[model samples]
Target: MKQETHTVKKEFIALMAILMSLVALTIDAMLPALSQIGTSLQVADSNDSQLIITSVFLGMAMGLIFYGPLSDAYGRKKIIYLGIGIFILGNLLSIFSNSFPVMLAGRVLQGFGVASCRVVSLAMIRDQFAGPQMGKVMSLIMMFFIMVPALAPSVGQGILLFSHWRAIFVLVLVFGLICFFWLHFRQAETLVPEKRIPLSLASLKAGAAETLKHPVSRSYMLASGITFGAFLGYLSSAQQILQHQYQLGELFSLYFGALALAIGLSSFANSRLVMHFDMAKLCHWALIVITVTALAFYCYVEVLAEQPSLTALMAYLAVTFFSVGILFGNLNTLALHPLGHIAGIATSVISSVQTFISVLIGGIIGQLYDASVVPLVLGFFFCSLSTLILIYRTRKTSAI
Candidate 1:
């Protein structure tokens, strides 16, 4: 019985991660197109281009909050379908867009739909796994999830080589169909009737309270939010920072790939490492390593007053993201650790809040983009510092 249950659980994790990768591709593939978008739409400011990236992040972030409790109430399969449908519609609309605002509108739609895949998939996983086992599964899930996002720019660049820019959405549509059918047929229901959470205000209050009531869960949630915000900030600015600021246009895909490869490699490493270390201690140590790296990058930008090479920027940012791979999966497992019973709701709200706050902060940071690396460096530096304080205080407050 246990072995059968475990098999079912692994299948769920595999299918759900693939579902969320559609959203990943939507966001990551747009990196090479950031410059094209600004020029085609005749937008006067490069910073405004960030709205394209942030719109989806912001939309998904908000969508995630509601998706959690709702999925708990409705069951994962239905919500997953609903979310995919919405994402496909958005992708279709984006394919028709010729203006920046209209394109952003499409991105927003895509984001909302993607949230269903992301938040619901997470809720489903948390329904079955926890601790080191959870981390191991999520790490593998992330490895697949990371591939589409990491290679999106490369894919986009390649598509652009032989086709119109909007052709990317066609791919989005194709993947959406695959994911929708895969879930519709192959994936079994993970959330049982007893697990259904009603979407009442009382439910929200109760769910939020339940998650927050636990010291470990609360710290992990808040820390994950801040740590994730740093990634969002990176996502928001990476394209513009790399292409426009660094004058690395055609090479954008290669650079994006390298950065993504760093994340993928580190994630696989993290899965193995977690077996040897406690989740919190590992996350805490990863935080220290990233903070020091960000600070060093910030110092280099400030004192050097010279434009860092593409090699240098990618290297430093890669270090920051490598820590992200280490921190994200474990932190998520930590947040869901004690909430096994309410894993669905916990996954939703935790993801929603973490992403919502991160996207907002990241969008703001991206808007600070100049023709330099200072803004990106400073953003990561401050983000790391804030997350450090939040985690430390949680530890202190818990002691009290």
Candidate 2:
């Protein structure tokens, strides 16, 4: 019985990681193909290629607002199935799209479909764990989730060696199908019927109001969005900065993977560290570190009057993303910790606000790319600094 319990726990963690990872896989795996996609779709501005990334985020932001309330009324498993089905359909749409606008629409649909996984998985985690233990589990899940970003660009690049960019969507489709079945067969529904909230306009209004009213939940959700917006800026511009600005050529994937590995390793460390320290303290310090790192790098680049060397840029990214890794799990856990009773609705509201803010902030930063890293670095500094102020203002509140 003990062994069975252990097996279930391990499988549960792995499954949650994969479900959350679908978003990362969808975004990062397409980084390598962005240029090709833009060229094929005949985009007038090269920078417009970044929309392929942010459009999905825009979809996610829109979807999260709806998925949460529905998941609460329905069940997690049903929502997961629905999300995967929509994801597959979106992939097919993208595969056949001939115009940039149509392709973006497809990506938006993909984002909307996968938003279910993000809301449901986090709600499920809330169903099973709480407090620092919940933070620890989130960190562990993140450690695995981060791996997708580490390898996705490389996978996308490898696929391009022999096939067109559309083939990449096909690969994503297959992976989505596999994850769909994995959940269907291996995971039991975490939200029970008795605890299910009825879906209604009034109920959603109450849940949204409740989530917004909780000082810790509201502040942490905002802080999460503010901080992650910087990272999202990095994601939206990574291909342009690394491949076009730095001229890494085919080696872009290696550098990208190395930086992703930094985040993954930090998440692994956070999983253990959460057991020893307050999750809030970890997030507080992480915000400081990234804020300072971004400021320093911006100053160095400004003084040089040129883009920093690849070595300097990588060093800065490694540190900033390491800080980002610590913040991701801790911030989300803090926001959700006080709202577990309404996990589904709460996760939706938090995620929707967080993702919408990120997309708007990140999309602006990406559009500012001008063969220099100045805009991206400044974006990081401002976003991190803003989060630091937000987190400090809410320090008196109990994170537990």
Candidate 3:
């Protein structure tokens, strides 16, 4: 029975990962098709094209604010069903959108749909597990997400090759429906019935006030924000940088696939590394790796040529991607360590704050795109330093 229970939890977490993975795939998959969409919609200002990517994350920030508490009041299973239904609605809307503005609205709603799964997945893991083990589970879940980015661009391109870009939305709808079915039939409620809290106006006010006062929670929250913001920076611009700047459109898949695999492998390493080293130590080292790589890219872009080659871009950026695996897991575990009593509210608040800031920061920075690789490197460079400073501050406070 113990073994059977373990298997059930693993399978449950796996299902959640599948749902969360859609966010990354949906965002990146549209990259190769961005030009086609713009031309078809007759969108002016090609740079504004990234609105398709950033708007969803913006919606996710709003969704994260509610999903966790709803899951806490109800159960993970029910909230997830609502998220899927909404996600399907978004996909349908997106498939039919003929203009950039309409498409942007559809993407925003899609982000909202997935936010529940993203936050609730983390909460459910924290709901059932704790300590280093929780970090390990989160890492494993992220490993699957890393893999999604690897194939997602290629998969989207393959869909484009066979049909209109609208086909991508149809595919997303199919995937969402399948997940909804899987959850409806097989998954049990991870949150205990009695433990669920009523989400009220009073409860929201109290949860926010309480979370703000929690230093450990706030530290973890900042840690998650800085690193994830750095990641969002990459996600927003990497494909454009690789495909358009470097002119490697079709070949973008092989390079993206490699970098993504590096992230997954690094997460596996982090799960093992965290078992032996502390979270702070692991994260600091991970940043160091990324810093060195970012610096190298900056150097190459600044000095090398009229345009730095795609080879240089991938070589350095892949190293930067490796840090995401470590930072994503450790920061959350460390942040939530002291907020066990309010995991649902705290998780929701932290996730919303993290996504909200990351999107704003990443979206603003990504807008600085040029005909060169300078913007990508500079964003990574500055964001890495900001992350280091925040972690340093958090460490000093923790010691006090």
Comparing 1 and 2 on lDDT, the stronger one? 2
Error of 3 at 39 (Å): 1.0
Tens-digit lDDT track for model 3 on 134-216? 87877888887778888988888898889999998888788788878887888777899888889898987788778878886
Error of 2 at 31 (Å): 0.5
The most accurate candidate by lDDT is 2
**Residue 64 Cα positional deviation in candidate 3, in Å, after optimal superposition:** 0.8
**Cα lDDT tens digits for candidate 2, 234-350:** 999999999888888778888899999999999999999999998888988998998898899988998998768999999999998999999999999999988989999999999
For each candidate, what is the lDDT?
0.81, 0.92, 0.81
| Models ranked on TM-score | 2, 3, 1
User: Model 2, which residues run further than 4 Å from truth?
Assistant: none
The true-versus-predicted C-alpha distance at residue 187 of model 1, in Å, is 1.4
TM values, all candidates: 0.93, 0.99, 0.96
lDDT of 1: 0.81
- The runs of at least 3 residues in candidate 1 whose Cα sits more than 4 Å from the true structure, single-residue gaps closed, are 1-11, 396-400
**Whole-model alpha-carbon lDDT for candidate 3:** 0.81
- Going through the candidates in the order shown, the clash numbers are 1, 0, 0
True-structure lDDT of candidate 2: 0.92
Report the alpha-carbon TM-score of model 1 versus the true structure.
0.93
